[model samples]
Target: MSAATPTAPWTRTRLRTSPGTATALFLLVLLTACLAAAFPRAVDRYEDRGLRRTLAAEAPARLTVDVTVEDPGLELTPEQRTVRVSDPVTHAAYRKIAASLKAPLTADPHESSYGTRSAEPMPALDRWLPRIDGPPTQLTLNAQGGLADHARITSGRLPHGDYTARTMEAAVTRDTARHLRLAPGKVVHFPDLDGRPISVRITGVVDPVRPSGAYWSTAPLLRTPEQRSTESQPPTHYWTAALLLNPKAAAAILYTTGRAQSYWQLAPTTDTLTARQLPDVTRSLASIANGPGLLSVRTATASDTADVGSHLGDVLDRYTELRSGITPVVSVAAYGTGAVACVVLLMAGGLAADRRRAELALLRSRGASLRGIGGRLLAETAVVALPAGALGLLLALAAVPYGRVLPPVLAATAVVLLACATLPLRAMAAHRRPHPHGAA
Candidate 1:
């Protein structure tokens, strides 16, 4: 057998042996590393913005509808001389109608009139928190939307019991729980309409969703004494502290005692309500409003996205974003750095072009076609860039946490670096002219 012609040293081996090629390879690795590190950080800002936008679009969370019972002239005021008696509309009737609707309707306290808007002073809520040690805060008993939707539970959970039969458990505010020296699995006593003791279990502790960080709960006593006779409402109307009652406790205190009169539109969770779902819910409410007790059932035809986000807008404020600081700055910086790095790498490629020209001319003299020559060139660079790009990737993962844009960023960077690395070979191949000795 003829001795095997010694294969020309691979293009990669020849390139690695040169000082200029080795230096260019080292510099390319570093540029790739810098890009890998910067790109992900830049991408994170946009990811944060996207998260904010998603939160803002989730507008229906704070939405509420009010179905108030107002016989404006019928109810007795505390300052009125003629003893007021006999409420024409009662909460029992509204609750019954709401129960039948089977929509997301529940009692809302803020929207319902608790004497704040009324010309007359109403009877104060009594015995709700006989144990609270400060001036009474704003409080009311709600069958549905009161506690669960308005506050986040910090510990334990919400009440679970027979809502229709007895006093259900409740979740108290963190401060209130701390004040009462209560925690999950503890019991607290509240006085009923007749001064009888009503005991409830403390199921959890919650933090209210207050605007501007204001105190979310009411005082434990009536703001002012309601000097009305037995003909009017029970003292349950004037509570200062939020005594978040479960359905059972509401039944024991409001419905069964004949004191409930208002119905509110409650959302189960902030995310539970959406604008798309609101149409059918409002339709159900409109039908239910025609029921006996509700004087005016007011619901939203459609809630605006900005209006909803204004209440609990995201930190990035992407939906209602008047201004943002993170995403734009990082984007500009990332592009600027990439452009500068490309220019520097191009210069490096130009400096190394002469050696590549002679190598390609020799390969062509041996009858290497353009396609085969290009493949050889790419393989040579890959021997350097592939390992360098991997090192750059490892550096990025170590510096920036993996998530969201990382995989895509790595992919994009690999493409760009590999593309840039081929510039010298392409430049050299295109410049190699046919010579007298048939080398091209």
Candidate 2:
């Protein structure tokens, strides 16, 4: 038999004799494959972190779905006179509408606020000191849900939900209490459009834990009273604030005011949101804003006139735009790393081919075909390259547990293919050249 006929044994013997070169080649392949697999995974992890950071930094108002419905207190009657809808029916309808609107959201509602407030401000007067005059103040009766969770009671206690009481139980913010010189146990009378006055007893003074948080964004005036001046002969400087009441008292406020503005809000929980879900969230918001999602909500609620609005869609759109701008940069970096790895692999393959030149020439003298020589080289290289590449990929996965699978898999495959192809191609190229020494 010819010396080169047992190619597998020769390849094994060559690797055993050149252990140092084989080890170096194996380490090189491992390092390059590791880098190739790690780059894209690292990018994916960074994107997810960035998305979470963006969501956390956003204002509550910018990330909440808000719906407003105005009850004009005028229902057309068959008797040609205006009739009012019962307070209980109106309150129940508002609750139903809010639930329907929030059903399609993927993120849990961090704060689901639904309430009613007087559309027009009413003149506020001190019940005890009726004759004594103070700065002109107006108040809008507001009954919002989940108030106790977001606020700390500084004095007295939270308002009781006593719909039967002649005087409505209410609370005021620290700012409003300070500005208006009001406190607990104080009774304030707000004159209604009808001759009778709506009496409210101050039960507690509250300080908002996060005045600028999403919860307070639902009712901004409650945190900071608005100061307005009219263009009258003697310019009137008046302050307007909302009086906090138990959610159960919403019906009474609607009854007293006759007409009021109601709001329903769904604030998304940012902590649970991930980069992978961003596209789906954006599409969902878009559907709610102008697509079939909005129509479905409207149909479910049976209220076409309800004003549905949100800044969440705009916020997500901006995030998508920012992500798109960053992707190309990351891709370029990954490609540059791969290019460098390929160059280094080629150099390593060339060195190995040079060391085996004498053996290759001897094989040629034994009448070994180029294909047979190339196949032996390929088999030897794959033994080292495939396992190294696989180990590198495993290391990358361990490092970034949250990364995508396909990108890293593709990266590792590319590295292994290049490493396995390099040595055979180099050996074939070197032997194809005409030699000055005619030993073969």
Candidate 3:
């Protein structure tokens, strides 16, 4: 064979040299840091809606309504009738009675006593009450905010004076059929303020009431069923009204003024007792049994009660201090861990560097300059670390949502590793001191 060809060190050695090992270590550290930075952004994104709502509701407002029931204690009458028009017990009597008949229709002319108890053939009527004689009476409010300025009609208002009926009138939705165990065509009864019986035809059905444990009004009708006879119906009662205000004004109003008589603060952070419990407490205080004095005034907005600006400020202030405290501790821990990893890596790189030093010196002794050595080191590092750091970042982005606690740290680490991989290879290469002996 011809004299053994001198292979160039760069061509001889693969990418797994001193520069490559240093680059790998740098990338690993960078992955740890990148994840740390992204965590807060994710958290803030999730809470943004809640924050805006709270800000709106907490600004301040008021609502006041007085409720009065015509008869809290109603007596069951002997003429308990079902919606069936064919039954002799109800239909015969309805046809025979005068156009304007008064109360106390008997169950039967011969039957002496009333028995609400269920018989073997049929269960007791779902509810035991006096039978309504005829169709419902109705009052169609021509004006918006019919009785109260803030009253909202949820459903069932046909044009004013739509029907003329001998019996009292009331409105019913398809859902009312289910509630009273009647079909769409069947009639159901309601008592007017004058205690005259009225019945409603099932008109329509829309969105059902809110689920039991939710905040907000869920009653189906805008106005309670109205009796058909204008002369017999009582003046409409005001049940509730929602007051509107600017968010800033609403925030202060919770503490300062509310015709509502009571309110309470809701916690803004997690989904829990704060939203459900505060509204419950406010309502409870306003209940007939509980005096309004027991009520604690509260803020109400269409938005989340917790997202009030003050609540967010409180959360941010606490989080800032907590994050401030945690960042230093984490930083120190990361630095210490990185230093240890770097030390371990340096030993390996140093060993690899040492093995190449003689060959490197021989080159330096010739035409090769120190800058050439540094360039070679950088080239080697890039070959190893660049892909590793990039791969780590790709993996991090993929794994962001699934990560438990260290997403932010992982992100920060990625940046750190990239910085090290790209900039420090030359520095590491320049660190070598001159060897005292001649080139090996």
Candidate 4:
């Protein structure tokens, strides 16, 4: 007989490769890995966008309340009263008063009521430390009980007349630095309520300070009373406040005919409330309080991206244990399912051997040994391993970005791929067929 025609070396076709089926499955795995990497960010964007939509649908609102002396013949001066009111409870009360007036209030404490706006506050400086992971709210003091002793007012200028200004070389809280808009060396003017100029020079950037309560996240070592008393001059009682500029600064602007309707119109028309507006608003609020007032504006319709991040923190804290517990269970179930599919496929391959019996007989008639047939089939299945492994590894590499956040899922997928390779091969044996006449 002529020498058996030699088969081409190492082609997938020689390996009983189901190119169409394998390609489709390979693409599916690849797509899944890609989705694993990118889907979380997409989900976050969608959530924030939806929140904006929801807020827009809600009613637009604004309100202003005066904190003037309720007591008759009050002895305290306006500045003295404002200073004494600078504590946390009084701050919350301002929000309470705004809420009572039916305003949708979100408080910000970094927006200055008085004094110059500096991006590099002591709190922002503290954030540069390596172990400081969260926001400024949790900023801790050094062993000496100083949060950031290195903090200093780098430059002071009277850019806007009579507002003694000092610029820190660091980032200030967002309420204060929001005016900076990431533009350094630019002039940001804060004016008093009477349009009197209050100058502040921007030096650097800072973190945005949000409202207190469930989402509160920043803490700086407050100046002690001794430090306050020992100072050559007393410090201004600084407070951050957000006022509604759209609904008109004062209720007097509300027309009796339709105050609520006018408020709605006012809300949308507030196209811009600059950093200058905060001083006046703070003064406005302070006029009510009789102290140095600091104020900024926040839109009821706007969704804060930082707020969404806080929500994610809540999700982790609330569901971390539950998710951790469920993850292993789900992974095991999924891996077992993949293993079962591989096992079933391999068993089915044995059934395929029966259908090919006649073909095997023809080969044997030509003097082919059972060993050769088994060797050829084994070689074909083993050939699948390289492509499969390569595909799995490529998928794993694609999973890197997502694995930064969701590592466990990506790891489980790799394990499944490895299991698929070995278990399926174990299903089939390469033993020779018995002789037709039962002769060994």
lDDT of 3 by residue, 1-440 (tens): 68998775672274434455555555654454434354443544334434344434442111111111111112222121111111232222222221111121111121111001100011112243222333222112111111212222245432222222223222232333233333333444434334443343433232323212111211112222212222346533221112112111111111111111111112222222232133343343233113422121111111111111112334334434555565676568657765665554455456556666666666665656666676776566555555555555555555555323355545555554544443335344643554433634
Candidate 1, overall lDDT?
0.45
Estimated TM-score for each candidate? 0.50, 0.80, 0.36, 0.31
Clash total of candidate 1: 21
Q: Write one digit per residue (lDDT tens) for candidate 2, span 1-440.
A: 66755455866876898788778878988888788888877887787788778877887777787766676333434221111223344445545544443323543444556667777777776533322234557788887767778799999999987754247889999988887677999888866556576788889999988787677865678677887776876766777778898876666665464456766676766665667777677676777667776776555434576667888878777788999998898778767877788899998898888877887877776677789889989988988888999999998888778678998899899989999998899888878743434453
lDDT of 1 by residue, 1-440 (tens): 89998766676566757757765676576556656565665465445455445644543333333333332223435322111111113334334434444344343334321111111222223334432233332333443433455567889998763443235576667765654455898765544546654555678877766522211322212111121223334332222333455543333344223344333333222223332344444555455444322322222211111011112223223332433455477669767876776666666666556546666666666676766666666666666666666666666665665344555356546544654456546654574553423353
Better of 3 and 4 by lDDT: 3
Q: Which candidate leads the pack in TM-score?
A: 2
lDDT of candidate 2 vs native?
0.73
Off by over 4 Å in 2: 1-12, 72-105, 127-135, 164-166, 207-212, 229-237, 323-329, 364-372, 428-440
- Per-residue lDDT of model 4, residues 1-440, tens digit only: 79998876643663344575445434444444343334443333333344344333332222212122122112446444333223232333334333322112223222211110111112222222222223221111111111122223323311111112222122233343332132345442332234343322344332322233111112221111111112235433222211111111112111111111110011111112222233343334433233212111112211111010012122223334544565587568656765665555455455545545555556655677665666565555445443544555455445443223344345335533543443223322322444443232
Question: If ranked by lDDT, best first, what sequence of candidates would result?
Answer: 2, 1, 3, 4
**Relative to the unseen true structure, what is the C-alpha lDDT of residue 35 in candidate 3, on a scale of 0 to 100?**
41
Task: Report the Cα lDDT for residue 399, model 3.
Answer: 57
Clashes of 3: 51
lDDT preference between candidates 2 and 3, better one: 2
Candidate 2: Cα lDDT at 149:
81
lDDT of 4 at 54: 39
